[model samples]
Target chain A: MYAKEKTGGELSVGGPSVRGMTNAIVVERLVKRFGATTALDGVDLTVAEGSVLGLLGPNGAGKTTVVRVLATLLVADGGRVEVAGLDVGRHADQVRAAIGLTGQYAAVDEYLTGFENLEMVGRLYRLGKRESRKRAGELLERFDLIDAANRPAKTYSGGMRRRLDIAASLINRPRVLFLDEPTTGLDPRSRLAMWEFIAELADGGTTILLTTQYLEEADRLADRMVVIDRGRVIARGTSDELKAQVGGQRLEFTVTDAAVLPRMVERLRPLGVDDPVVDEQARRLSLPVSGGAEVLAEALRLLDGDTSRIFDVGLRRPDLDDVFLALTGRAAEEVASDDDTTAEPAMTGGAR
Target chain B: MSSLAATLSDSVVITKRNLIKVKRVPDLIVFATLSPIMFVLLFRYVFGGAIGGLPPGVSYAEFLLPGIFAQTIVLGSTTTGASIAEDLQKGLIDRFRSLPMARSAVLVGRTVADLGLNAISIVVMGLTGLVVGWRINSSVGEAVTGFLVLLLFAYAVSWLMALVGLLVRTPEVVNNASFIVIFPLTFVANTFVPLESFPSVLRTFAEWNPVSAVVQAARDLFGNTSPLAPVPDAWSLQHPVLYTLIWVVLILAVFVPLSVRGYGRAAGR
Candidate 1:
């Protein structure tokens, strides 16, 4: 029912339907545990054919676990998962055939050249020898790796390796693709480049399930967002919907004197829906409010003739960061940094 | 394509990938060949005089050559375990697992490629043996059989190493752990010396040790065995070729399924 409801909004035009299916990937109440630790508990999501669902969470929040299970690399402790209309548990081989996974770390063999890596994957996918080579060449060209196609993957830069990895996953033209942190450690330029590639893939109508810590990446690429934390879906919506859920806009003011903060909050209190946040030490007041420019005008009128006490004033709409803070009670970067010291080393091969 | 044919084709793909690594990283093949050559030179010139239990017609070089072949291929098989562990650590196994190919392809491909390496090592060791005065005394067929038996045993051992690789799941640990078991398994056998010289307990081990059987089979086929030498009492050595084939079969039977199962369950940490 949910799958039917979600389809046809922005499904790509004339996308190939390999299995003549609607929902490309679906999971119902998935449960997974590692010994006493529960990595994923009762998680559920779906990706419509030719749509992207961004799985957002902090590190160790079971994002990778979900991807692994859907990719048929790990068996779930309980619940049902299907990719391309085939159950992962009973028809793992079929599921593998329909789905491709690019893991958190680049999984290319460093010893093999880029062309050779793609060709090998293609052959394994049961493409005939000539077809496999042809597909490899096509992918290398598309990924802009044709120049270095004959060079070993070890010599490629971080971005190039990531591109090659994604290219290898695409060799079989899988119906569903799982990308776990595709641009995790890339530079800004490379991240932008990867984003463009992902956008192009999205435009081509490939069904994708992307797990990422960068909210900007998810916001830019994912049509829908599912936020998970500690093995549970805490929130799910489009970028604009999630932002709106955190409330409309904020009226913020910074004053030269800490003593003026409370005065500012009192003046704007009636205009805001909730309590205005006052920080004496920072000498600032931030209040949530509805109406657009008129509210700013009214707030300015309320503080008219008291402008000498205010250093700055502005009306700001909530970004995904605010929504994340409101929902998770921790900044994204804080959780990411905390996770780095505690998470297990990913064991990236030669291309550091 | 049918399932079996698909599996075979996938296996060939993986095998080619592994062979490319062998060519790209010369160190892997170099060490595999160099170590056996070192063993040949060490036993031939340095310890050949100190150990004097050889039969009259059999030179120490001839007697030691078969043992060195057994040691070379058996130890060379560890490459399977080490490379498997490396793949697991590097997340390549995870990538392969996610693919639609046969689950057993990774193990089959690895052992097959390692078998090729074992063949190369054997050839190099053979040439080194000739330079050191070791000669084949039997007909060409027997010598060819000797080579086949050695390769078969190495192929079997590669599966055992693959299981070890999956169990340990790290290249450095696989290297260290394999040696702890393999060193004594090779040395306690008749690899470096005549079985008659070993202590009773060690001699019994050597007589039944697959490594010793392989060495004895090679010696018999290479025409290096001497009539004047004291015959081994153990039935395994008395019928060395049969004993060696049985071990190869048994090792393969036990390790192939175990390795494949372990590989399927190995989730890259």
Candidate 2:
């Protein structure tokens, strides 16, 4: 409650233009290995002050590893990491004071009441008794957890537990916050509530670095995004820029005959921006194209030999799911199984 | 001095949080009390005539009191290790690690809370022992010293468990590991039987075991020692009080630093 909020110098949620401000998080050539597996390999990233950078990747993508290193929870095997200008490994205590971390799982004390959890974190932050209670009360009210404030956190729903987790992180009003998959296992309703709450924090000028296998989560929350797969940064840009990487919309059509797929591909090549991807098993062919409806019109005119033979055809913009598949050649959900899914999303590199 | 104050203050805050966990869930307190109640009833009625009857010049219940105290308090230390491991698995340790507080606060707080919990169980068991005709023949000062020594030794054992808890994979592993080690460590000594009743090699082990020294020391202080209280064959049994104190200090010296240092690297759990 005592934390101050600044005005002006605010950028829109989607715009990630960081021309002048100092970066809150600077990570360069970071590497972390577990036994024989490398979790992070030569990864580099910078998040501007008062901006949100979403670390995006599939399972075994090293997103959570990067978060742990920046939060000072784990030591990096190599490279450098600094949070709010303090080196995480060297000035850990100071970096700890400046930042709040909501790990991949909700880290709130389940045995303690929601109010007690926030108050305890406040005391850990060295806030005096009265100030701690006051801040805890304010946060509980702000997170809409005042109704269940006195109940043990274990009794709260998944969404409430996550809200309390985030509220605890804000106890010290940290300059930067690390949220690793803040909405990983939540129902859609709770996940949306969490997204709005996080959006509010960023709007208030707190710098944030969040990691998620949910591409849409990163797309909605992060101003600048970096995609890491197999412990390497494969792509980095704004949400729009990352979307642009896959290039416009995809045009897909299903041919009635599986035998005619190759012939259809040759006829569609001239209309496509890139070579069409053929799924012979599904009798489907999809090509990336710059134009939307016009590309479809030309494709139908070009492949008019057997218009009746086409079962399905459509043109649509590439969503995050398509981006993930395009970049990593696998769906995001495929990387996370029920066992290791809710835990660390990206711990293993090569195998399940 | 300021650093000392900071460490103490941070430890106090952490201790308060840990204690609150017990308070919020009074089931933990009830569970802690239940085990001591079970032990007292079982040892008094079931194994009383045989194991409890070996010592001379005192009733089996009275003679068995010191051994019970030593065993109960030592087993209580296992809770310390298990609780720390549980905290690690639950991500509470990660939360504490990310805080700008003293590095040793979490472990210190956990051990102190476990110590407090152990003391409660001791009092509960002491009352149960009294109901079964166990008496303190010694003066109040000596009785206090006896209980204090048992607590100190238990606290030392807790540090060892704390280190084990940090290095292990899970809280369940800590429970299993403590049972494997503590059961043999406490049972192989003169905890349940008199040294003279054991075979030759077993008698020597019973005479020199630190658990035996702790029990013998408590019995001497409580004025419930057998006629052969001195156990002159072994130096440890001869000076039970001094030997137990030496073991206490030695374990504390080795384990406190190891647990604290291990906390940093133990996050994989």
- Provide the TM-score of chain B versus the true chain B for each model in turn: 0.98, 0.94
Leading candidate by DockQ: 2
TM-score of each: 0.87, 0.88
CAPRI quality of model 2: medium
Give per-residue CA lDDT, model 1, range A116-156, as digits (tens). 99999988888888999999999999999999999999999
The candidate 1 chain A region of ten consecutive residues with least summed lDDT is: A343-352
lDDT of 2 by residue, A151-247 (tens): 9998999889899999999999999999988988887788889999999999999999999876568878988788888898877777777778767
For candidate 1, the clash count comes to 0
Q: Stretches of candidate 2 above 4 Å error?
A: A1-19, A251-287, A290-316, A319-321, A328-352, B226-230
Off by over 4 Å in 1: A1-21, A247-324, A330-352
Supply the global lDDT for candidate 2. Answer: 0.82
What is residue A221's positional error in candidate 2, in angstroms? 1.2
User: Each candidate's fnat, in order?
Assistant: 0.88, 0.75
lDDT (0 to 1) per candidate: 0.85, 0.82
